[model samples]
Target: MKRFFSLPNEIFSLGLSPGALALYSYLLYCEDRKTYQCYPSYASIGKSVCMSVNTVRKYVAELEGRGLIITEPTSVITRDGRKHNGTLRYTILPIRNAVDRYNQRRLRQLEETVERMRIRKKLEGNEEHPA
Candidate 1:
């Protein structure tokens, strides 16, 4: 897996908890296809980061509610093709009132992902293909 990236200290200005900021960073680390995009799973994330699933879930919920991130539970193909990895279709909602400007392009990527995943499942013949 690639190294995790920070959401920048400016993210804290969005009124997010430190845990939430970390979780949000992990989410980005997991989903980012550019620059250290590789990321661990929830279970791996929990263990690697030394947080219980319940605690991770709690902060995840907080991040969700705060509009710092968007999530939809779903299964995604693992980069290694070892097994299908379950992931949240997460899109960081840039705080318009804070640092950087809104990233409309990344938002479009999330939209496109939803559409692509819908198409992927259809083409998969519903077979588990080990991933």
Candidate 2:
């Protein structure tokens, strides 16, 4: 097993909960390809993260909600007509995309702050300086 890289700062900047981050990290570690996609059982992930299987499921949903991972759940039917749950396929979103989104959101917030400042200055009878 190869440990490719540590969690990026952008992941924390996304405001994910601790459980979500741990599950995401475990998924990254288990990823088998350059694409950063993996198939791991909840029980395996739970054991690795020292969390309960239910907690792992909850946090996986959290990661998915934060757009950090995409999960596709599959199902199979046996010949005797029994339905079995299939492994979950997780695709980790690219860090570049996450960073780009964070930068864009920061830009919007700054823009809003500047606009508010301009309004405050105008109400205070301050002359606008030409840039």
Candidate 3:
């Protein structure tokens, strides 16, 4: 049996690096169909994505920063009653939400640029008029 997942076209427009994109795709592939969540060790993800554990960690942070995924720390109790950290629980957020956020941020940046240009033009006009 072959497993597959779909990647949204808008993800490419979000300006994520290749490593981040690969990690996000791997998470999507691992998530449950009903829950959109998965628990995978950093080593597991790294092995699957051909990245080092530290690189996987970096990309995971990148995805979380971009609102592409939410990661929760997990703990497990050993048979001896000792507690230890376990694999992280990753919840894949909706691509639409990410796309909306990206669009809004870009719009704000463009607005700020336009305002700066307007101010510069006004300053130039004042300079030319000797006012």
Candidate 4:
């Protein structure tokens, strides 16, 4: 039996670095279809993606920063009745949300650029006319 998952085309346009894209794809592979969540240790993700644990951590942060996923710290109770930190729980957000955000950001940036160009043109015209 082969396992598979779909990667959204919008992801490529999200401007994620290669590492971040790989990590995000791995997380989607591990996530439960219904729950859209997965709990995998940094070591597990790193091994699957051929990245160092620290590198995995960095990509996880990048994904979170881009609103592609959300991570929650988990805890486990040992036989000694002591609580210890466990694997991080990752919840995959809808790709549409991320895409919308990315588009919005790009739109804002373009608008700002256009406004700057308009101002520069006005200033140049004023200089030429000496008014």
lDDT of each: 0.66, 0.84, 0.94, 0.96
Ten residues in sequence with the least summed lDDT for candidate 2:
122-131
How many collisions between residues are there in candidate 1? 0
The per-candidate count of clashes, in order, stands at 0, 0, 0, 0
In candidate 3, the residue pairs with backbone N, CA or C atoms under 3 Å apart (3 or more residues apart, or in different chains) clash, namely: none
Give the range of the ten consecutive residues with the poorest summed lDDT in model 3: 1-10
lDDT of 1 by residue, 1-131 (tens): 86755555667566567777777777766766553233355677687567898888898788766666666666667677766646656666655533333345456879999999999987786576545
Q: Per-residue CA lDDT of candidate 4, range 1-131, in tens? A: 88899999899999999999999999999999999999999999999999999999999999998999999999999999999999999999999999899899999999999999999999999999984
Error of 3 at 46 (Å): 1.2
**Candidate 3 vs. true structure, TM-score:** 0.94
Deviation of model 4 at 86, angstroms: 0.8
Per-residue lDDT of 35 in model 4: 98
TM-score of 4: 0.94
**All candidates: CA RMSD in angstroms?**
18.5, 4.9, 1.1, 1.1
- lDDT over C-alpha atoms for residue 126 of model 1: 57
* Stretches of candidate 1 exceeding 4 Å from the true structure: 1-6, 33-40, 76-85, 97-131
Deviation in angstroms for 119 in model 1? 58
